[model samples]
Target: MSVAKIALVGCGPPSRRWHGPTLTELSKRGAIEFVALCDLDETLAAQCGEAYGVPHFTSVDEMLDRHPEIMAVDIVTGDPSHHVLAKAIAERGKHVMVEKPMAITLAGCDVIIDACQRNGVHFEVAENYFRMPKQRAVIDLIEKGILGDIVRVRYVDAKAQRPFEQTARIRGLTRPFSKFGNSSGMCMDMGSHRLSQLRLFAQSEPIQISATVKRYRHSDEFISEDWAHATIEFESGAVGLYETSRLGESLAHYQITGTQGGICDHQWSHPAIPLRLQMGEEWKDVPIEFERHKVDGVDVLSRIVVHTDPQIVYVNPFREYAIDDWCVGHAAEIMSLADAALNKKEPEYGLGGRKDVEMAMAIYESSLNGSMPVKLPIAETTSYERILHEDYEARFGRPIDAK
Candidate 1:
C-alpha cells in the first residue's frame, strides 16, 4: 500500500492530545509519511513538532513550498478557519482534511467545495464519532436487520454544566462568542457529531426539523445558545430527538428504537457498558469483547466483537499501530484522506459532512423562527447564517468568502 505524505496544521490542544500522537503513531507504523506541522502560533507549532519529531512552520504556504511532496494536509483548526484554510490549501493543489462542522455556515462550506472542485483536489471532513469500532458494530447490527426498521433515534446530554461553567469562567462569561473562536456554539460544536450519528443510526435523510435554542444561564455577551432541543423528521419516517444543554440536569441518554428491537446506553459510545438490546420483553446485554495487543509499550485495540446473532466484528485496520479505541476514530479519519488522495476515490464521508452542518443550521433556523419546522436542503442562506457571516466580517474586517 502506498503511504500518503501528509502535513498537519493547527497545533492547539486537540492536536497535542489527539492528532499529534495519533499521527506520530501512524508514521511510526509506516501508515503515512508525517511530514511536518504548522500553526499561526510559532510556539505551539514548535512544541508539537519537537514532541512528534517533525519539522514545524508557522505558515501553510511556507510548509507546502518546503515540502512539495506532501499530497494532503490535515487541518485541525477551529470552526472559523476551516473554510479559509481549506480553500487556500486546495488552491495550492493539495487534498484537504478538515475538522468538522465542515464550516460554520453553508456558504462557507460551498466556498470549500467550489475551491476543491476548481482545483481538482478532494477533501474529507473529520467527523469521527460514527467511525469508532463500537459505532461500526452498532451500525453493522442495524444493517443486518438485528434492529428491524429503526423507528427513533434520540440523544440527550442533560446537566453537563460543570465543564461549560469552567470554560465560561476561564474564558470569562463576558467574552463575546466571536466568529474566530474555537466553537460556534453548543448546536454546531458537539451537535454536529450527534446529528451525524443520528442520521447514520436511522440510515435516512432528515427532511424537516423543529427546534428551540436558548441561553438560560450565560449573559448576552455569550451569544450562542446554552440549551437546544431539536426534533428531526427523517425521510424513512424515523424520528430523531436531539436535546442538549450546557446548563441543566445531568444525564446522558442515547438510544435507537426499532420495530423489532432497541439499543440503549447511558453514554454515547462507551464500550465498557455493554450495549443493551430489547428483542424480547426484557433488555439483554450484548456482550462486547475487546482484542488488544502491546505495540511500543502501549495497549492498542486489535478489534472489537459484538456478540449478536452471527456476531458483529470490527477489526482495527491500524491495529499494528498503538491506537486506542478513541484514536481509532482519528486514524480512520487520516486514512480516509489518504485513500481519497492516493486512490482517486471519494471519501467514506465526503458530502455527508455538509449534511451534518445543514442539519445543525436547520435546527438553529427553526429556533430562530419560533420553533417552526424548517425543511431540508435549506434552499437559501438562513438568517442565523447571515448573523454569523456579519459577525465574521465585523471581527475580521472582511467578508467570510473574501479571497
Candidate 2:
C-alpha cells in the first residue's frame, strides 16, 4: 500500500498529546510517511526528529524545499504563527490541519481561510471533542430520537494548570510564531474546544452567545483569561451553559437535559451517559455495553448496542487508551483528509468555513465584551472580511483596501 507523505509543523507538547501517538499508529498502518518535522527550537526539534526518526528543520521553507512532495501539513504550532504557517502550506497546495482557536484574532483566521480557499487547499480545524466515540454516540442518540428534545446542556472542563502553563511558557518563549494578537486570552484559547463541542452535539449553530472570563490567578506575560463561562442559545432553542477553567484540581463534567431524558459525564468515562429515556415523570437510564476492538492497533474496548423498547435506545461506546481525549477526533480528522486527498471528495469542515470561524470568534468577542449576546447571521462573509481588514490596519497602519 502506498502511504501519503506529510509534514508536521510545531512539534510542541500537543504533538506529544495527540499527533505523536496518532502518527506512530499511522506509520505502523502504512498510512503516512511523516516527511518532515519543523519547530522553532532546533534542539528540541532535533530531539523529537531523532526520537521519531523523521527529518527535522528549524524553518518551514527549508523543510518544504527539502520535501516538495509533502501532501499535507499538520500545523501544531501555537496561535500567533498559525496563520503564516497555514497560509504557507495552502500556498504550496498542501492540505492543512490547524490546531483550534484557529488563529489568535478573528481577522488573522479570515486571511488564512481565504488564502486556503483561493488556492483550493484543504483546511481542517483540529477540534477533537466532537469526535470522541461516546460523544458521537450521544449525537447519534439525539438524532435517532432517543433523547426526544434536547432542552439544555452544561459542560465543565476543569484541569490542572501546571502542564498548561509550563508548556505555554516554553512554546511562547522559544517560538515567536506561536503568539496570537494581544486582544486574545483563555476564552479564545481553551473555550474554543467547549464551544465547538456544543455546536457539534447540538447539531446547530448558536444564534446568540454570551460569555465572560475571570483571571483569578496572576500571570504577568499573558493577559488571557484563565476561566470562562458562557450561555449559548442554539437555533433549536436549546440553551447550553458551558464553563472551562485551568485552575480546577480535576473536574471535567458535562450534562445535557432534554424533554424526554438527559445525559451526563461526571466521571471522565466514555459512553459518559450511553442512553437515557423518560420513564414516567422521572428519567430512566438505559445501559449499553461494548466489546473489545483495536483502534489503530491499540486495544480499545467499545460497545455499540441498541436496546429496543417502547423507548428505543442506541449506544456507542467510547474508545480508551493512553492518549488524550483529543486523539479520538484526530483519527476521524485524518481519515477525512485521506479520503478527500485520495478520493477527490471534499472533507467535512473543509478549510476554515465561515461558520466554524464565527463560532470560534463569537466566543472570544462575547467573553471579552462583558458577555454581550452576539447574534450569528446565516451568512457571516462580512464578519470574516471585516476582521481581515481590521487586522491589516492594525499591523500595517493602513487598511488592506488602501494598499
Best of the candidates, lDDT = 1
lDDT of 1: 0.85
TM-score, cand. 2 vs. native: 0.80
Candidate 1 deviates by what RMSD?
A: 3.4
What is candidate 1's lDDT per residue for 107-223, written digit by digit as tens? 989989999999999999999888887788788878888778999999987644654454343221122256468888887888998999999999999999999887655455556
Residue 118 lDDT (model 1): 97
Q: For model 1, which pairs clash?
A: 159-249
What lDDT score goes with residue 232 in model 1? 96
Query: Against the correct fold, how does model 1 do in TM-score?
Result: 0.93
**Model 2, 208-246: lDDT tens per residue?**
877665555445654455666778899998888878777
- Per-candidate total of colliding backbone pairs: 1, 5
By summed lDDT, which 10 consecutive residues of candidate 1 come out lowest?
Answer: 167-176
